[model samples]
Target: MTILENIRGPRDLKVLDEAELDELAEDIREFLIHAVAGTGGHLGPNLGVVELSIALHRVFDSPADRILWDTGHQSYVHKLLTGRQDFSKLRGKGGLSGYPSREESAHDVIENSHASTVLGWADGLAKAHQVLGRDDHVVAVIGDGALTGGMAWEALNNIAAAEDRPLTIVVNDNERSYAPTIGGLAGHLAALRTTDGYERLLAWGKDVLQHTPVIGQPLYGSLHGAKKGFKDTFAPQGMFEDLGLKYVGPVDGHDIAAVESALRRAKRFHGPVLVHCITEKGRGYRHAEQDEADRFHTVGRMAPRTCEPSEPSIGPSWTSVFGDEIAAIGAERPDVVAITAAMLHTVGLTKFAARFPDRVWDVGIAEQHAAVSAAGLATGGLHPVVAVYATFLNRAFDQLLMDVALHRCGVTFVLDRAGVTGVDGPSHNGMWDMSLLQVVPGLRIAAPRDADQLRAQLREAVEVTDAPTVLRFPKEAVGRPQPALDRVGGMDVLHRSDDAGVLLISVGALAPVCLQAAELLEGRGLGCTVVDPRWVKPVDEQLAPLAAAHRVVAVVEDNSRTGGVGSAVGQALRDAGVDVPLRTFGIPEQFLAHGKRGEVLADIGLTPVEIAGRISAALVRVRTKSREEYGR
Candidate 1:
């Protein structure tokens, strides 16, 4: 068996010698490249963390010690060391989760992949250990990109204030989050990274000066007192040290011995300590290292030899459609500025950023800042498009509501990966944006069905100068344009039957499914009318009247069943005195397991066959209830 196969648990790592450990790290990297190439995962990040993960497991006893990983995509290496080595179906149904999963092992904590949160979890866990008078250590591994978030700083403030807390913070400085980490923190880390021999100089000074006699002790003391100024000249790590946390080395992260030494020192320290380790992303893979973009931050299933995708492209993705259109729009509208929270390329803002460099801003990993900054940009007479993954917008809901909506800022929030992003699991799924944004007054939300609607609705959203607007699209390839049979106010009538009994409301990407369901219903002798509300929020005014004409109304969306477009339509129908029996079809209120988008949707009864059956059953129930009332 190989070294990686031998590492069934953390205890297995402690038995390995220095050379064997180095060999293990190499084995892990090779295994990751081959395994992830077959199953498509976070290839570069995992490859970069191979040594660090091994070093950490060896240094700290996880489960007991509580080694928490921030934004847990980097925990794949951690998982492998902790006995879960099967990568055959990583991120697939009934397989290892893409992020840390508590269900998978006792070693895994903070299952959610949200960034900059591990520090807070570490703080609380450390406090718990302290309160119980237990001796377990708490080590949080956070990326420099995650450090850009406000929450990490907030946790740092509290952690620093408590000088006796036995907490170790490992700053995994890979210098990138999607792209290179930007802003002041990145510069600070860069300064620290460039100070190559600062630690050696300090050690040399202490040894030489202290060995010289009575004058030597005081002289060394004076040098230590002036060390802050001396350090500022070299590393400039006064920011962390000044906060009262013991700052350790800008060590080589890829060097197992150096990283283990630094970690051991941190483990011995009684107070909160920060160990800064600098490493390169995609450290082993040549194609990944050479690639300028995100260093293959996330990869699809591919051939390991050529580093090419296993399957050919289906068509232009929803993101590409949005990217091309946004860049085109930027050319025509000079006042249109864009903002992304460290995900310019991922959120379809690459072209926009390239075309209008001055107008676009990458606001680090701070989603709250993105929302507020967009509000500021809007207040300055420019329409700002804050594009981000829909799930991430949950972090900035307060800002979007109070800062933008309350002030009536004309900010357009473009949410790519809007609904049911399957593989990355529950935290990555963009299923809650519609439900969350439903309560924001004067906030209009558009759910585009196809490439045409995405382009047209995006234009409409930006043109609304008085209120905040949102345009949400899924992560899948953009489908063919579903031409409208007719229009009912702002809604598009996808299919209308001459003797329609069921009025089906389709939201966003589910328009095609709704149309197919309508066809299935027609074969079952139940005529159906399908409508796509281009803008789902505020529920088109004509919907109540239209619903009144049908026997029953059914609203289908790819979001949560609670408080989504379905709920909004129900409320509109009730207020208009229509009293039409409505059945809402959507994702049930539960954390869906990792699977393909179609598989998850079908499991949740979002498929055409499933939807048609449910609607037909609902009609039967309605008829039975009406007959019983007549008998009464």
Candidate 2:
């Protein structure tokens, strides 16, 4: 059997000989490269962690011992080793989740994939263990880039304050997070990475300390203290040690022996320890290692053949579409500008950056700053479209509500990946944008069902000068275009059957799904009408009449079921005394696991089959109740 297949858990790794382990590491790398190449996962981060993962598995007893992955994308190798070896179906629907999942395995402690969160999780888990009288060690494997987040600093401070506790913080210094690691931590890590001879000195010191006696004991103590100077002079890790956490390494992370040894050493420390590991992102893969900008950090499907078309087929996304159109507008309008929180590439603003080099700002993973900065730019007479992922936009909720919305700034937010994003797992699904943005006073929210509406709505959003406007779209390509049956106060009637027994109210991506559901209902000789309610914030005036005609009004959205577009419509209809049965079909309030977008939608009962099944059942119940009450 292959080394990967034979390995069941961390204990399986602990027994392997060096040659056997080396062979296993190679097998693991090969498996990862092949798997991720097809699926297009976080290839670079996973590649970097292969040896580190092997070593970690050998050193720690997981399930009992907690190992938190900061920006959990790098946990792919960990997943593979922990008996989740369905590599072919890596990010597919019902496959191994793209990030570490608590449900997927006992090894996964945190499902949060966003950068710089594991430190706080580690701190909390460690504290909880202590309170519960559990002796399990807590290790947080954080990337060098993840350290830039403000919360990581706060956690570091708290971890530092708590002394004589066993907390090992593994800084996986790969020098990248979708892009090269930026800020103070990156520079400090680089200093350590560049240090040569320090490895040999470290090895010699360790060997000498083990063989010492009486004067040898005093010598070992002095030498251990002096080694701090050697590391500080080489790597300057005074920042960690000064915080009262023992800092170790600049160790070669690819060397499983080195990593295992370092981890074992860290186990002896009574207080918190920071073990800095140096590994190459995309270590074994040529395509990823050479490629710049996140090294295919997160990928869509492989690009199609040469296209000589006017518009994109599976085209340049709504993001790219927005980027091109807005850049053209910005070229003519001097006051137009843009901002992205370390996601220029993800949100389709790379072309815009190339055109107006000065106007485009790449603020490193700081969404709060991006929101408020756009507000400032708006106030200074510059129109700014803060293009970002809807998931990341949650990071700037307070700033959007307090800084931009309160001031009534004309800042346009182009939130890409707005709803039920697939593959990337729960942290990435843009399901909360509608519910969260609902509280912002006077804020207009627009969700386009297709490319044409997306382009037009984005243009409209840019022109809004009164309060902030948010345009949301999914991570995938533009959805199906529903032809307008009637235009009534921001909502477009897509379809209305003669009987109209059931009204399928569509929200954003759910438009297509709802329309398909309408078709199923139609086949069953049921009256089903579909309306594409384009803007979610300002309730459509036509909903009252639509609800009155239909026996049941079912609102469908690819968002959280709580206080979402469906709930908003239900409330607006309630205001009109259109007390028809309203059923809100949406995602439940929980972190959805990774899968294909369609699978996730279907799993959450938002697909045509699921939606149809639900509507048919609801209609039957509503009709049955009416008959029981009347008896005329």
Candidate 3:
């Protein structure tokens, strides 16, 4: 039998010969090309990490010796070896997650799909291992591009501090992150890729010259004398040793035997060491190699809900709505421009880039720079709409609060994927936007329930001349439109009832659930009113008087139950001396797993049926208390 078919887990991989291992790597690559084409995932990154993953499993005993993936896209190869061979249902509703999921396997250490946080995890795991006297190694496999992030540096500083911190940080030098890696460290890493064993053999040859006869010694010594200057001119890195890391390689990452030797050497080391393995992002696949962008970094929705070709380009996502709306705004206003943190295509701002090539700024994977620069753009009398994913916005929180919100800059923050984004799981979810952004004083946050509202609210946010405004939306479609009833205190009342006992307050794209929940409550004999608090922050003053009028208020939102808009409304009512019992409904604080958005929402009791049931039960208790007090 073949080695691959005989392999059930990492244990089976340990027995393979070098020839079999190389052959197995080819099979995995061919398997990925077909599997990823069918399912459409981060194909290129996984393709690059095939040999690296095999060497990792073959070298380290995993689950005990923790392996953490920085961006997690590269973990697909790691998954395949650890018994996740079924790529047919990958990223499907009930299928395997796009990133490393802790629930999916014991091999996955940290469930991070986001970039640049793996070092911090590595530091923590290594420290934990040291404290508990656990003899296991904590290995963090991070790409070169992940090095650009400030957090990675911060983690590096800490990891460097621990003198004998038994950490093996494998620098997967693909020479790129999303776009090509930037800064001085990228240059340092480039040296590792280019300056192979060419310099080493030269030094060893010079040593042979000294041991030769008198005539030979004269010739050898002259060349050996000039070697320092020559090697200095040739060698690309002087800094890795300065950082106290034992620098090894510029080794061919694609070659399994070379990588296995390097990893085997890294495994025996005591202190922190960096094994630089040079790899091509789209190593084997020609289509991905030619993909001038990020080698199909994150694939857009390929097929329709029916698995047909009519899917309409990832189905006119909320990201597209922002891109088109903002571009239209840019056309209308002469001073308007756009800024994105290395995500022009993902944010759907490619058309803006095409139209106003000079106006659009594609700042490379740097969110902090994007925000602070937007503040500068606004300072120069231009209205800049910073379009970034809500999760990435977390990176620039200090910049947002200090530079933009504190100054009250006329910067429009268009946050796409503003709520529970499913398949990407815990790290990628925009669920915490409400809780965190609420702390930004003078920042107005609006959530559009549909595409139409997204357009209108975006324009309104842009037109507001004095303060910073944010428009948030989910990853999926902007479902059926709801006519705006009233725009009071920056809130849109989607549905209202005169004799309503419950108030359904929604923030952002989850207004559809409020409307549906209202319909269900209507059927359940409880009068309900749904209010889409379009702008979740600044505490809609009108909502207070509305809550004062109602006996019981249940606020339904897609954010966290803690410090969210729902909690704020509950606190607001209590502070205003409104004796109404408020039930704040939101996602409970936990790491949510992979599923369809609808299925995840239903699982968390955010569905219309659950909302209606909770509201109805609240109403029954309140009425029963009223009857007991009045002697009825």
Candidate 4:
């Protein structure tokens, strides 16, 4: 049996010898490559942290001593060590989650997949430990890229203030988060990784000075006082020491022994300590190492040997459509600049960046900074298109509300993956964007139905020179265009029955499904009229009048049912005194599990059949209620 096979829990790792641990690391890597090849997941980050994770498991007792992972994608190795070897349906429904899950294991503390949050969690845990008089240690494994976020600095400040707090912050310096980490913090980490001359000198000085006569102790104390100055002159890693936290080595993260030694030293330290460990992003795999763009950060199911996708794409992705259109827009509009939160290629800004290099800006993994900076860019007479994943935009809600929306900046937010977004799990789904943005005044939201609509709405969004505009699209491939039968104000009437009883309002990519639902309702003798509201937000003024003519109105969206386009439409109808029996078909207000997009939709009753059934049932109830009230 393999060394990894023996590792049932954290205790099992402690028993392994040096050679066995080395063998176990190799076994784990092979397992990861094979397992992740079959079921796509975060391959590079997990591959890089094999040794560090093993060392962590050996040194710390998890569940009792919380070992928190920032952005939890790196917790694959952690999961392996904790006896989760079943990778058959990884990131799929009823299988292992891609990120850390509290439901899966007692060892997994926090389920938040968002970056730069582990340090804050560690601080809180440490504070709780002190208050409760518990002896448990809090170790936060944060990536070098996550450090760019303002929250990491905030947590660092708090953790540093409490000098008595026992918190070990292990900086996993793979030098990238999604892509190569940006900003001054990444530069500082790069320096620490390459040059350790000053650290060596300090270590030598401490040993020699302390071993001398009575004057030696005093001299060493004096040198320690000026350590920050000396560090500033050479290393510049005194930032941690200045903040009242003990600074450890820039150790080899791949070397299990070295990492274990560094971790042990940090554990011995009574206060907050940071152990900087350097490792490559895709260490074991040659294909991943050769990937220059993002080091194979995330991947679809691919051949393990060549690293090519297993299956061909069905159609052009929504991102590519946006990419091409944005590039075309950049060519014409000189003032149209682009901004991304460390996800240039991911958000379809790669082509735009390539075409207009000087106009594009990658603001690192700081969404808050990206939103505020877009506001500044707008103020400087440039219309900045902030392209980011819908889920990540949650991080910059305050910035979006205050800096952009409050100022009424003409910054256009292009939200990709703005719907269910299955397989990545709960934290990854973009179901809350519509609900969350509903309250933001002076903000107009556009949910494009097809590739043509996405292109048209994007152009329309940039043209808005006053209020902020958001154009959101789903993760799936762009479907075939459904040409409108007629146009009612800004809404596209896709299907109109002779005697319409139900007005089906389709939001974004769900237009096809809504049309199918309308057909099913028509078959059941309920005449239906389906309309695609190209721009969902500011609840199109034309909808109230259209709904008043119908007996029943239903809004179908890929977002959350509680506060999605459905809720906005309901409010609009209520305000206009259009008392038509309205029903909403959308994702329920709960964390959706990982699965295929279709499977997840079906599970949540977002399918066409389910929608039509619900609408049909509601129509029956409405008709019965009318007869009872009127005494007919």
Cα lDDT of model 3 by residue, 1-632, tens digit: 54556667899898888888888988888777777667667878988898999988888899889989998989988988898888887876768888888788999877766778898998998998889999898888988887767778888778777757788888898864223333445445334322435345655776777677786679876775564344334333335644656555656788777677667666766667677788888777776677787875655444312223323544577877778877787777878889987678888888888889899997766789899999999989999989899888988999999999888899998888877887677787888888888888788888778888889888888987678898888888766678878766667778877776787787767777878888898887777777787777778778788877787888877788888888888777778778888888888998787666777888899888888888888889999999999995
Candidate 1: tens digits of C-alpha lDDT, residues 1-632: 89888777999999999999889988888999999999898988888888899899999998899989998999899999999999999999899999999899999989889998999999999999999999999999999889999999999999999977889999998973223233455445443432435445766989999999879989998878785776555453688988877776677788887788778877876778898888788889999999789888999999998987898889899999999999999999999999999899998888888888999999899999999999999999999999999999999999999999999999999998888999999999998999999999999999999999999999998899989999999999897889998998988889989875999999999898999999999999999999998999888899888999999999999899998888998889889999889999998899999998988998898999999999999999988999999999
What candidate 4 gets wrong by more than 4 Å, as runs, is 176-225, 229-236, 629-631
Once fitted onto the true fold, the runs of candidate 2 whose alpha carbons sit more than 4 angstroms away are 132-134, 176-232, 299-316, 496-502, 523-528, 549-551, 609-632
Against the true structure, candidate 1 reaches a TM-score of: 0.93
- lDDT, candidate 4, 3-67, per-residue tens: 88878899998888999999998999999998999999899999999999999999999989999
RMSD each, Å: 5.6, 7.2, 6.4, 5.3
Give candidate 4's error at residue 270 in angstroms.
Answer: 0.4
**Model with the higher lDDT, candidate 2 or 4:** 4
Q: Residue 149: error of model 3 in Å?
A: 0.3
* Steric clash pairs (candidate 3): 447-508
lDDT of 2 at 221: 72
| Worst 10-residue lDDT window, candidate 4 | 176-185
Q: Taking the tens digit of each residue's C-alpha lDDT, what string does model 2 give over 1-632?
A: 78988988888888899999999988988887667656667777888889999888888998788888988888989998898888777778777888888788988988878877889999998899889988889999998877777778889999999876689899998873222223455445443432344445655876777677656667877887875676566554778877777666767788887778678777766668788888888887776777677775764444212112223366456677777777777877778799987778878888888889999998876788888999999999988989888898998999999999999999999888888888888889999999998888999999888877887787888888879999998877664566788876778888878896998888876677778889999898888988887888888787787688789989888789998988888888889989899888998999887888878887888878888888899999999999999986
How many angstroms is residue 232 displaced in model 2 relative to the true structure, after the best TM-score fit? 4.1
Q: Model 2: which ten-residue window has the lowest total lDDT?
A: 303-312
Q: What's the CA error at residue 223 for candidate 2, in Å?
A: 17
lDDT of 2 at 12: 88
